[model samples]
Target: MALIGRILFVALFLGSGFAHITQAEAMGGYAASKGVPQAKLATFASGVLIVIGALMVLLGIWLDLGALLLVIFLLPTAFLMHAFWKETDPQAKQLEMIQFQKDLALAGGALLIFALYSGYGDNLGITITGPLF
Candidate 1:
């Protein structure tokens, strides 16, 4: 169940990260439209962060670090990209709100993982910082 959960959690980001590479120009344009500075560089950097973080989490390699990266990725992204309050149109606001909620939920999940890996509430004292078995 843990493995499955981890896999599902990383799936969207894994695809999205790769998509930035395959659809670089388009993604850069979208980022530019979003007022991101150095849109192309930001796009590629985001892709790298997303991929590395997702891979680390899914593979159980330095799970704490992975979770931290995820939090960093989702925080600004949620408030910036899914700025629901900034949308005046009802439908657009609703859509952005949903996206924002999802991002928050995902960030929560990452935080949970971070806490677990950080030895926040574990009696076992087992911390695996390498590849999953």
Candidate 2:
């Protein structure tokens, strides 16, 4: 159950990170629409961070650092990209709010990971560094 949960947890970041890498242009355009400067670079950087962070946390190596990266990505993203307040349309606002809430939840999970295992990864028996394959 724990292994499954771990896989399910990192799956979100890995999937989205893959999309961000493959569809960087589209993602960057979306970021630009959200008023992010250097949108392309920002998008790419975020993709890398998400992938690396997810990998670290998933493998149980540097879990705290990985969670921190996700937190860094999540905060600004929740505020800027999913600015529900900026949406005037009721439906759109609802959608943005949902996204924002999801991001917030994910951030909370990241923080929890940090709280649970910030300094013990190297000595912990449950985690390994990097991918198993």
Residue range 1-133, candidate 1, lDDT tens digits:
5667778889998998899767878899987887888888888888889999998888777777887898898989898788999999999999999999999999999988787666742222333454222
Worst 10 residues of 1 by lDDT: 124-133
Instruction: Show model 1 residue runs off by greater than 4 Å.
Output: 120-133
In order of appearance, the predictions have TM-scores of 0.87, 0.89
Error of 1 at 2 (Å): 1.7
Q: Give each model's whole-structure lDDT.
A: 0.81, 0.83
Candidate 2 lDDT over 42-130, as tens digits, reads 89889999999998888777777788889999999999999999999999999999999999999999887776665444444357763
Candidate with maximal TM-score: 2
Best by lDDT: 2
Q: The CA-based lDDT of model 1 is what?
A: 0.81
| Model 2 misplaced stretches (Cα beyond 4 Å) | 119-125, 129-133
For model 2, give the 10-residue run with minimal summed lDDT.
124-133
